[model samples]
Target: MKNLLNSVVGHQAVIDRLTSLVTTNRLPNTLILSGAKSIGKYKTALGLGQNIFCKSKVGASACGVCGSCLRVKNEQHESLQILKSNDGLIKVDQAREVTHFLSKQNNVGEYKVVIIDGAEYMNSQSANALLKTLEEPPENCFIILVSSSLYKLLPTIRSRAQIFRFGSLTTGQLKQIKPVDDWLIELSGANLEIMEKLQDSSNQEIYMKLASSVSQLSESNYDACVKQITSFTKNKQHSLVLIQALQSLIHASYKKSLGMSMQKIDWQEPALERLSALTQSQIMELFTESVKFEYYQKSNFDILLIFESLFLKLISYFNGEAHHASMDRYSYTP
Candidate 1:
């Protein structure tokens, strides 16, 4: 626990609360680990899980060197179950699968732990089904619901759990982190996804390239936009990384709209304005569709057609011709 706290910068209060919960024998049955996505909620939950199952530190803390701790650390623990996602949602059947393992007493452990990384995406049926288990969870089971937006979850499901909000790095604290420029650039874009990955130094070059691509994308050059994004696609190993980059762009633009500072970086005003005009919800709708376009590229969707659609959408928004653009009622409605 001390190691986890010391590793993640800032969020001291959250660390304290989690440490208190684990070390004091006051852990909640259903914990809502609420915070922005990629802000360490899942990682924290896993840390808590490790501490829970660590055999050496038997009483209330984890002994980092124990066999149990090693297993959990390597994600080989039998009792530790993580439901990644199913059918674009954590559906009822998936939740049912959890019940199967949860039904059995921990085979060789004291506790059975489950962490739902994106609980908000659990559809209504699955959520309600999970609520039953949460309402009367097994004696030694721990349920951690990690959410980026708790509001997207049902109040009934929420009421069944103890909601703990995740804390973010203040600008001052973030400025102190290593690779300050890179981290700040990500935070400025309000992208939790890339921020976490940036901590992994190996991805630094790719992260910076993606940042440059996002900053440089505009309608002035459709071919350039395609080349940049396509190049980004070629370079990125995971499709989710690209989506996360776009998500960060959305967040940073929103914060910029609210006048948040980027600390010492000389953030170009025109660049931000151009980014805002190009994305900012109006462009987000199109950009989001672009992901599906990228996804379908493997199965009949033309890459040019997809990027072209995005180019036109960005041009309309950039030229203040969005009102005249033929967007669906739902596209720019929000």
Candidate 2:
């Protein structure tokens, strides 16, 4: 039988475990699929939904061509509810909607499945609003919380669910899913979302330019880095891609400094070599700032100011000046 679960790229162990639970009808009411971003946790949730609602299941998997399977594939299924974040948050109103959704009868299938992608985006109020549902879910209802940041979820919510951790896909597995250039795959850190972003020619161009600027960065040329990055940061999505790309470079450089062999990409080697010169502590500082910059970007901070500030600190690192700027000024509760 052509199984829908077979379509998911990696995480075979998770698939097998889920298949057993579904086949035995012992699947939990609440599940937490925790992992790094873009490693296909949501896809696994969808595959599980398909198997649960599959009308023509041969064994423990969906037929992938039945009416129920197609609807789920198209995200048009009546029983499968997928909630994604808006403006980087799943607010209380969305939580109320989920409660309302599960409250109603399961008219279309044996179960009502709610998959919240980026589950950590749920604020305290929203998480509290959904706690009752999590604690006492209606019979035949399944809620799958998909998150890259498991620590951010409320303990009560985590306590009520079965947690499954996912890891990054391997190069071979990534290639099987999408046969892109090897450098592109490495740049994505085996993450599907970043790989997709790098597929665009324009994004590739921006990545090269950014990589070159950062690789050659010095105290005197730091302003050039700001100009290059700010030009693309005007688009929020582009800014995110740029930040992730920078982080990838930093990670690769740190590994190289530790005597790890990285696949040598012509365009990126110069930057990697440049970054590898920093001490381990310096590398960590850059990484820490990058993470904070990413958080601010997602939280709707002033993009231009943050980008400029980030470059200023970058220059200080090269100039041998201690980075003393307080990040609390840009911090928000979210």
Candidate 3:
């Protein structure tokens, strides 16, 4: 338990609560671990399972060296089952198979633990199949549903499970774990996993490219902005990275406009400063539109028009013109 708690960055309150529940032998059979992506809900579930299955526990903690502990650590435990979506949804057949798996007695371990990784991806048909099992969960069996969005889950399934909400770390809390840049942390919305990954990844080239595009926008070079974005959208993966880079710049500038010191690298500060020309609300609108365009891009929207529309919106905002681009509906094209 001590090691497990230490491995996770933040959310000590949830850990303490789960620890207490385990010690009291009153942990819920079905638990909904709901929180933002990369916020440690899945890790918490794994830790809780490890502690519970550890045969030689010492004072409300896992021994870490026991056979059960080793299996859980290596994810080789027979009693532990992990369910994930295929393509985009967890089909009804998969949910039914899990129900069948739970029906059997646990011969290898004392408890049967099932973790639905993207619980929200369970469509209505699959959710109903799983709901039957939740209604009458087998003894010594545990179900941990992990989701970033809880509202997507069926109400009946949620009602039977004890929901535990996880939260992101604050700036001060994040600093305790690693020396992550404050701006990067804000960009990740305080998700430590995402912040660390972004830090380690080689995004410098794309960041520089994105910076140049922003410079063009600052110069009121609408044609250049369109050309740059059009070239970027050619590679879907690169285009997504550009959108993220834009979001980071917008966020940094928004913070600076509110009297906060800019958190990005020194070179990027100039472009961010130029973006500070717009009010906080206008900056927010632009960021929101960029996010929408990214989503539309994923759904196979017309790439040329999407980037062109985005460039036009940014040009209008910078020129002090209120351009209302109707995002009420997206026109899909192959």
Candidate 4:
């Protein structure tokens, strides 16, 4: 809850740059912290805010135990305002609220920090409202837009902010954060968020079931595989995780086809061996389709239909019935 910069797992370069900027009083008023989900962008934003307001500073970082740091961590700081999505979108009203908050005078620190987590969820109207603020933010006000899909943001909004891209954590960095099983690590693709989800017993069961189903995919079991995978799609979050797991399996198979070594996880061997039969291009297509479906999960599309289409494509590929073509050309009818 504290989200101190010192507690961040990776992105040392970005942190160092931010620290230097903060020390020199040259940090931009508007910043876009763009990265994959759960990679510490929001945490870094809070940590920087804490450092800015910390009463007992420690070498360009927050003391973490100071009263100011505690307030920021607990989201009770008067000067720091965080706006998250309502339902699935950040409405114009929320953007207006941000405008109003920024217009006010700072209460506790020299700077008032506004963090828009999940900034990509801003609809057109909300984005336009927020754009006016980004164009000319109030003096001593800092706004950090944390987004996983930067491209979804309006081009005008993106142009007004200084962007810092956060990359995926390495295995070593992930382990430094917390010890994780090798199989889970491999499945998570070194994503802390996915790894945390996989750690849940129920989620793990779902993942295992998915892996098992995918491993046995064949002409004989095609209908059963579709039914089983679609059953898991009743939960949107579980569906996303399954899609991610599918991508991981395809990625491993792609690597194996190239004579690359895979994680020595015994359980994944069957899936890897089966998927390795796929040509590199075929594997790439499946991976791309999975990524597409993952994005679709955020939309209002029919989840069951989406997974069914995905499994159909996957089974076709496994049966050597899929061809190298743009997935756009492939149409699905209910």
Candidate 5:
């Protein structure tokens, strides 16, 4: 089936806004779609781009059977160019190439659309190189900058684009679009994009390992948590995955303590029930710590040391051994 405008889940308001822009022919040349990772910004941008280029649009929607729409759907459209980092960061040369492409005319479609996925991956040099193009974009050409990290984007580049923030999908929305794995939905906190990745059977095992690690923490088995982290996670990215799993566990527990409904994960619910003894403030504190842990991971700090310290802190909290004194002294800085 074609991934048309309606194929994208949730974000009805974003869809509505895009419909208005397209119908009124007021679509901006530079647009920044921002939101949490795997929350559908990139998909929405791609779908919208197709709809804009489709020769036969049906009242703000694209006619999927049309040749133009089919080509765009299959990523064979000559007028559509997508730029994304292949090696972790969008290099300056990529930006320069996109700038050159945008300066030219539309090849086959009515609009030339350029999608820069992970726009935040643009380093200082790349961002600066793209600034001029954003400032004076070519006619009938639209540039979409998709990013989960809004703060990382250069302010000058952000200022030149019309920004749209895509929010997380609600439980109801998640159920409608992706319902095969409800537990994954709960664990992801309705981040359907991430849930989609977790849908792979292989990923489920990693999540189980992570859940086991959290369960170990509740039992005050600090060594088990460390071993699990080391065993399943090989590097900083892997450590971040473990951290996300832990964050999900903590968040689920927090919701449970508040009498909020949550889908029960067989592996995680046991520890979450035990962790109910944790106060709201303590849960919030750990949530904050997870944020810092992510920052430290991104900063290229020592991976083993970071996970070890985090597991140790989790042990302290679960054992009622954590204190303000220790919280103040805890540092993951390299």
Candidate 6:
């Protein structure tokens, strides 16, 4: 029905399946949609809600001119209930609200609809409450659960629902993105356009300062790791992303030290030489620990202190010939 349903961008496969589900009258009362943030998973659920609420049922198709359609579009439908996540948690009371709403007779529509956003936030009690409802779903009821983290849900609760996986966006599909400074990738929780977004701002000053200090960390030359990471994460706070980028540089340094790769970023030579004195595993351990430390910094344990301590570690790792600085004393957990 041209009625209450709204269109969503990307994921044609998901759209096609949903359309089929509605058209065939085989719609599942419990729908678990998992995907990234800012993506259209919740939007899709809303679309499904509209279709279910549409009054006209011609071979399972919704007619937009029906009273139900109008009510759904205006969000005045008595049988429709929407539950949102609060403080990253969707409580049991909200789920119970759905049950209560659905139990009532439809004043203007044939069925009841519930849209649960961030269903992953449902705590143990909340999920158990939902399990009660899902186990004995009332006739003519539709429940759509949207979540970013599916594994975080209870296995019994998850098993009761039909799972619909929403995949990531394609590069070409990125055109639909609103022109934000940095695009948060819904599935991965990383910023894809962070560096591009940062290229136009005064934020370069942070990188410049970071770059200057990068050299202070090493003896052979701090350029390799320092230049790559600063140049990369300078624009983004993506945790796994920066770690992955840093991993590439570390591998390159290892290759350079073994004289396997002829092409090296000029700044890495001193680092390669100094690191050559250490075993590959030691270097790996150091890099791995630093990656965890970076994640901790990003997750809000204290960014400045982490950065300063990390800076000191880098200096120590690079201090092949340069006299060791007393930067260790400066390290403190903030």
Best by lDDT: 2
Q: What lDDT tens digits, residue by residue, belong to model 2 across residues 146-232?
A: 999999999999999999988778999888878888888778777877889888988887778778887768767877777877777
- Put down candidate 5 lDDT per residue, 114-214, tens digits, no spaces: 99999999999999998988998878899999999898899998899999988877777768766656777778777765687577765666677866776
Would you list the rank order by TM-score, best first? Answer: 5, 4, 3, 2, 6, 1
Clashes (candidate 4): 0
Give the better candidate number (1 or 3) by lDDT.
3
Candidate 5 ranges beyond 4 A from true positions = 1-3, 105-110, 175-179, 200-225, 302-334
What TM-score does candidate 1 reach? 0.60
State TM-scores per candidate.
Answer: 0.60, 0.77, 0.82, 0.82, 0.83, 0.63
Candidate 2: stretches off by over 4 Å: 63-71, 74-101, 104-110, 118-126, 219-227, 230-239, 296-334
- Kindly list the per-residue Cα lDDT of model 6 for residues 1-334, writing each as its tens digit: 4633335668778777887888777988788988866568877776676677665655554576677766765656777788888998888788788778877765553778888888888899888877878988888888888888899889998898999988877644554654432222221123334434335444343433333345345534445434544544443454334444344445555565566734433443454554565556656765676667555656655444455456556555554433245664665433
Q: Order the candidate numbers by lDDT, best to worst.
A: 2, 4, 5, 3, 1, 6
- 316: Cα error in model 1, Å: 17
* Candidate 3 residue-wise lDDT, 1-334, digit = tens: 3445458778988888988998898899999989878667787888887888887888888777778877876777888888889997999998988999899866664788888988999999999998878988998899999999899898998999999988877788678767877767766656665576567455545666666667677335767766765665677776666667777777777777888754457667667756766877888877777678677768756666766665666666777877655631332222
List, in order, the clash count of every candidate structure.
1, 0, 0, 0, 0, 6
RMSD in order of candidates:
7.1, 4.5, 4.0, 3.9, 3.5, 7.5
- What is candidate 4's lDDT per residue for 1-334, written digit by digit as tens? 3338878988999999998898888999999999988778988999988977786776777788877888888888988999999898999999999999999766555788999999999999999998888999988899999999999999999999999999888888878877987778877777777889888887776666666777888768867877777767878777777777777777777878988765766677887777766788888877777777766777746767766566556677777776435653444322
Pull out the clashing pairs in model 3.
Answer: none
Cα misplacement distance, residue 297 of candidate 4 (Å): 5.0
Candidate 5 or 4, higher lDDT: 4
Residue 235's lDDT in candidate 3: 76
Question: What is the lDDT for 35 in model 6?
Answer: 80
lDDT of 5 at 201: 66
- Model 3's C-alpha root-mean-square deviation from the true structure amounts to 4.0
